[model samples]
Target: MNRRLILDVDTGTDDAIAIMMAGLSPDLDLIACTTVWGNHDVDTTTENTLRVLDHIDHSDVPVYRGLGKPYAPIPFLFPDYADSDRTIVHPHDFPIASRTSDVRATPAVEWLVETLRAATERVTLVPVAPLTNIAAAITLDPRIVDAVDEVVLMGGAHALGNVTPAAEANIWHDPVAADVVFQAGFERLVLVPLDATHEAIVSLDQTRALRATGTPAAVAAAAIIEQRITGYNEILPTGAADTAPVHDALCIAYLLDPAVLDVAPYRVQIDTVSPLSFGKTIVDVDNRARSAANCHVALGADATLFNDLMFRTLSEGR
Candidate 1:
């Protein structure tokens, strides 16, 4: 059975890989791709999305431009814009990521709301960026909660976080909107947090394997990953040796093969107001907190099997 998917992305390097994975896969029907602001600005995100879509001949999938910021405005007032506010610094120019021409319409929030409301089959919502657009849709029509079948997102972390000490980049980017989805009482919610994703690493070997395939998808993925790795190494001290943990792709992988991951349900909450802990997803494993478990969280991933699946996707699965 082919599942209908509405993928929400931020057009980061990992997101580019995710777009290819979902768009190329025959098992999933990517109805539309809604771009958000996280890895880059709304405009950059949209452009990168179109570029990736162009790579796999999925330019037909409607690309809707989304919000510039979170549904709730930023709380802290920085008199000056910080570097963090700007686009994610990529190592390579990503000439492929820079396609300003052929941009489509805007106000993705409307399309998101209308599509969910009108869909006959329940659509699988895969949000790989900040949950701004998802929160926006819920605000316009809270009833869209019931319309969604499941939400598989890539955000948060189990213990260690990549963004702040307590939060992952996606969750930290916009914690308020994340709070809405966590408490919206959706029937099914699954998150592929940093905990599980860090295990499914894309090392040099995988890069070579992908490149060796010589397919357009494999070549494109290798190019992006290799360039990103180079960039990370040059910018950060620990970048060179760091494995490319294509975080966003984990969510899509989980949707296709649940066996590749170890998912467990737990009561989760978002810290929306703490300066130190904002955007952190707190899971109550002891059930000490209030509210029943509203979502399933991944604690572990079968890295070997996951690598195999990813390789298969590039080689033939897609």
Candidate 2:
């Protein structure tokens, strides 16, 4: 039986890959997609989501727009706005990222809460974006906290983060929202953080190999992967070769193939106060007695097998 899922996303290149995986993976019954503002603005996220759905032939899956800003008031900051918090660079500066110009009718938060309440089975929220929508859903109806089977999120970093030295983009976008979800005492919440996503990087050579598949899905995937790596190389100066980790895709893959991820019971907490560590995920790796265990976090993964699955699944056009 396919697991019923609602994907909350901010269509980054990786988010596109995740959507493709959900559309093709037999293990998932993707009910809908909700767009958020993380990788880019809310408008772009919603538009790109439609474009991606069109590619995967999942246009029938209703897409909902989400919060335009953080759950709490955030300073009106822009990466390009001179003297407007220039220190905090937005992830959109990356080359591989794309932004769309359209917007949608419904917001994601309302869709999430109402959708779960209506579903006969416990719904799983696969959040590959900021936590604004999830937080809003729980706040709208506290009962949803129990109705949800699980929340599989792709954000946070057990170690260092990509967008900031301490904070990841998804969590940093809305730390308060993230904190609420982490402390809500949801029965089963799993996170595939940077620690695991970093392990699932698709190298340039690997992407070239994927192109050999020659299907529409495979070609589209290869094109996106290529754009992703090119952006990574241009944005971050790394000694290693150019490659972009398919961060969001791993969340769906983990649900489909648990063995692709190596998880450990972790006491996870979000830092809401520290200026430098806001949204940083604090894991009790030392296994101290005082840390409260609330979530399971993936620390390792098998990238080779993951890439193989992506190639085969997309090639077969499932």
TM-score of each candidate? Answer: 0.91, 0.89
- Candidate 1's residue-wise lDDT over 1-318, tens digit each? 799899999887888888888888878899899999888788878888898888777788889999988778757532222244223334225546434346556578999998889878899999999999999899899998887889999999878676667778788778889998888878899988988887777777788988899878788888777765564454432333745577788877887798978999899998887766776789887788766789999988887777777777766745
Count of backbone clashes for each model? Answer: 0, 1
Residue lDDT tens for model 2, 112-178: 7777777778878899999998888888887887778888999899876776777677887898899
Among the numbered candidates, top TM-score falls to 1
- Model 2 off-target regions past 4 Å? 75-104, 237-239
- Each candidate: what lDDT? 0.79, 0.78
> What are the C-alpha RMSDs, in order, of all predicted structures?
2.7, 3.8
Best by lDDT: 1
TM-score of predicted structure 2: 0.89
Which 10-residue span in candidate 1 carries the lowest summed lDDT?
Answer: 78-87
**Cα deviation of 192, candidate 1, in Å:** 0.9
